[model samples]
Target: MALLSHDAGGKPVRAASGANATLYCNESTAGLSMLHKELAQLDERVQRLIAAYRQARLERKRALQERDRLLALNAELKRRIEGVVERIRLLESDQAQ
Candidate 1:
């Protein structure tokens, strides 16, 4: 059931659900033709915010991928350096003998 009544001036009043609640119209409509315009503006703002959030999520994923790649490269370089050091140590031992 809709909770509504008309004031003496013929303006619609929100009743029942609200305590002597009065507006030009329903709470959702908020009265008049202004409601449509306001709803459109609010929708546009929400869409823009959602798009920004999606772009940020994509950038974060790409950054994580790059970090993993660099870490792998560092590990490979460490292995190669350690191998070279071991060879140098063996050469010194042979020379000393």
Candidate 2:
């Protein structure tokens, strides 16, 4: 399914036979360059994660503020309902008398 070759270091290099693609390996500095490339990729990934974390924190803060406002609104509605119920009870007692 694939082609395999070796460099001076005898490292197995895999390539796609259909695409006629090969890995050009320079035994002198392939490992060092690959290491640097991997490090760069890792740094980019870490930066993306940090940005996502900051965005999540901002969204969570906004959600908590909305929840607090809703709770305050709920308390106010409950107070108004209690006042109405008390007036109804007073009217009932007066009718009975």
List lDDT for all candidates, in order: 0.78, 0.80
What would the per-residue lDDT of candidate 2 be over residues 1-97, giving only the tens digit for each residue? 4434565699875665443443333432577688799999999999999999999999999999999999999999999999999999999999999
Question: Model 1, 25-91: lDDT tens per residue?
Answer: 3454455358688889999999999999999999999999999999999999999999999999999
Give residue 1's lDDT in candidate 1 (0 to 100). Answer: 33
Query: TM-score of the candidate numbered 1?
Result: 0.64
Q: Candidate 2: list runs displaced more than 4 Å.
A: 1-25
lDDT of 1: 0.78
Identify the candidate with maximal TM-score.
2
Q: What is the clash count of model 2?
A: 0
Taking all chains together, each candidate's TM-score versus the true structure is 0.64, 0.68
Query: Which regions of candidate 1 deviate over 4 angstroms?
Result: 1-31
Q: How far is each candidate from the true structure, as Cα RMSD in Å? A: 8.0, 9.1
The alpha-carbon lDDT assigned to residue 32 of candidate 2 equals 66
